[model samples]
Target: MRWFFYFAYICTMETKTSKIFGLRSVIEAINSGETISKVFLQKDLTGAISNELNGLIAQHNISRSYVPIEKLNKLSKNNNHQGVVAEISPIEFADLDAIISTSVEKDKAPLFLLLDGVSDVRNFGAIIRTAECAGVDAIVISKHGSAPVNADAIKTSAGAAFKIPICKVDHIKDALFQFQAAEIQTVAATEKTDNLIYTIDLKIPTAIIMGSEERGVNPSVLKMVNAKAKLPLLGEIESLNVSVACGAFLYEATRQRL
Candidate 1:
């Protein structure tokens, strides 16, 4: 089944391909290190095959949507979609450790961006775009409570997601400890503090934490941070959007680094 899928994929001229028809074929694509952007499951799907597909999607952190059979059929162009379709990517993820090691080896202060519970794909993509523009060493995100790196995110990032190193951690606090142990100061961006972003000296090795829109930073992660700062707001609005805040923080760091 996998061979058939691969043969079909090889014969196609399309730069990107979507898998359809069988459950195992989609699973094989994921297991074989194929870049799955998204997966669509028929709304009424159940039984062994459905269970297995669900498990694989969770394991690989693949974004999925429950849709009607008609939707899947439409997506598969009236082909034998078999209640599933998976979108493949044209690029791959970067090595997290290599990004950090290279930054230190070059005598560069490690400028890292940590996103805590940011679920919006557009926001995540926008942040990556800014991080790449500001020359961030890497972006760290928790395995859960973050946006999946799907095709929409990649497109919105203008391919910066492929260019940037994105580290997925199980526990954000543990990752913060690792960065601190490596001599990187962990900075959290919050409206709770009075310290202006410009006042913080980002010339040193730094890791900036940007939180979610509704909840802000998780308190457990907040406790692990070395310092907390805020972007001064003169307008009636209290805070900035997460992505905009991230860009402001990163570019401020860029200024100090220069």
Candidate 2:
């Protein structure tokens, strides 16, 4: 099944970047270790080239989508895309296991941010920027319902997306389980909680789950976290934007750690 990526234009951190289009160019980029965010291939494009692309995707764990030819045309800006176009990412994604190990090696507690369903590109970017500034160890998000790491996200992040590890997992729940087994606490930031964010002992290794502004944290995820916390919102505005709320939550953890 071809997946269409309908994201707005996003500029790159560097002025000079190789524009990769067509199957051969994309295959070369993948083989040469280029940081590709995702690949868009025309739906039902099957042949030796597609087979080779699938093989490389399996070998490198690259993100891919199958979509209509029109979608591919739009992505390639009407260039001769040959049924494939690869978006190159400036920053290489970090492995979750390696991130955890590095923190352990340094004898430091890990602080990770997990987004439940933050699909807004700007919001995702802001969270990434703030997480980097707050010294977060990594930012994790499920691949299914999260925003694509496009140019707008990168630009909105002020390039902080390049500074931190953004780990895309198969499932948020499974990742939470790994953190628990590793003795890391997972905290959900939501208004439904009476417990204050300041009261949590965030100095320990922790992962903070921040959800969309509209829905807050998922109930299932809330139940699984070690603690539920909220910032006292004593104003006419019912809530803060997810990005603002995330920044607040992360900084409180920073305060506790310091």
Candidate 3:
């Protein structure tokens, strides 16, 4: 049974992954209008191929990484990567402005989720799934610190990630400001808050910021949020899993809105 579980995990990790290896193949995939999430290049790569890849990256504004050969090999599963690999995103990212505007146009308040340092793929996926079910307007995540929205994440979300808009920004702080600029109040979920989530009025345009389990929330981000909230705990456990807490917060907002 353990072996079967191991095999299933391996198959899940490898199967249905849209990865293009080798420089030529990656370039071709990009040229074909595929939505490549990011390209990984071997560190110390040089010559015409490297230059060509760089040119294409700049031309298409593609995200890239300079990694060791071992890393590339792992990504390629020991296949012939030829010093390059590109991950294709299963779904398109959403535009934050458009999401807010559409929500307002439909006479619905915008409710978004902003994740701070939530790098666990499974947790991220679960939060996305719950948010979609809760009818969140969109989800915002930092491009650098957030988990990769890969096959596992998509599967864990049960295809909800594709149905919802995922707005990736360079930083969560800036994204929070963008929400405020659009008249959406930013709320942070942290233990520092004595205010219960249900007590806070979530019927208005709102963006809820959830931090990683390791770190409750970035101090700077906590300071910037319009309100801070915490879930009530009856048990001895001091905290809830980030995904679970997020679902609770989102549903509270949903209940308020409805």
Candidate 4:
């Protein structure tokens, strides 16, 4: 098999993430510096090796949960899972500082896409695909309250997740500060702004921010950005889907940069 992923233990949704079963395999993965998102362990598991795994998981600050053995059995297809399985992120995240450093060395201006609380994996993936297609230099997402770079996100991205550099920031506001320091203008996509997207100068280095599905950009975030712009809404619909709006924003930048 090339690859397969599942989330049998989740009660909220049937979203799938790449997984590797067995305790020793997980330990080896951690030792080899694999991007492990979370680890599921059988309840009441103990002993030296399990203890070692626990220590390693803690040391790396990886999220973990203790579930029933039956849950582990389902996750592992009844195979010997050694009471543990780990979720692995398919794409390795890039460093924001590194991206900024190298982007300045290039001849062309850098284009970055930042997601503010976009939690839907499908939406996140679609935005990623659009950013990659628009020649975005990098994508920045907050570490918490964001969609996982799991199987579904990668699938929805049509493999663009691997092609583009996705950087995880401790907070979206923190990233805005860094972009400002680099002299990259930050633009937020929101309806609150009176300025239209067409008026903004995107020919220079810029980072575009897209907000969550439920709400537009955070009020605090909007305050930090250098400029705020919105796409023209000709219809009665008050808002557009975050992904669709993101495509429009990125392409406008593309057109201006061209």
* Number of colliding residue pairs in each model: 0, 4, 0, 0
lDDT of 1 by residue, 51-100 (tens): 98899999978767899988888888888877898866555655556666
* Residue 105 shift from truth in candidate 3, angstroms: 1.6
**Candidate 2, superposed: residue stretches over 4 Å from native:** 1-19, 105-108, 212-220, 233-239
Residue range with the least summed lDDT across 10 consecutive positions in model 3: 5-14
Model 4 TM-score?
Answer: 0.78
Over 140-241, each residue of candidate 3 has an lDDT whose tens digit, in order, gives 887666777788788788778888999877789989888888888999999997999988999988999999879878999999999999999999999999
Best by TM-score: 3
Q: Candidate 3: misplaced stretches above 4 Å?
A: 1-14, 55-62
Backbone clashes in model 1, listed as residue pairs: none
The TM-score between candidate 2 and the true structure equals: 0.79
Whichever of 2 and 4 has more TM-score, that candidate is 2
Model-by-model lDDT, in order? 0.82, 0.84, 0.87, 0.88
RMSD over all Cα atoms, model 3: 4.5
User: Any runs in candidate 4 off by more than 4 Å, and if so which?
Assistant: 1-17, 21-28, 38-58, 61-85
- Residue range 1-258, candidate 2, lDDT tens digits: 112221222333434343579888899989998877778888888899889998998787766778899988887889999999888866667788777777756667889999998989899999999999999999998765677777768878877887899987877897898889788999998888789999999999999999876787889888899999999989899889999999999999888878
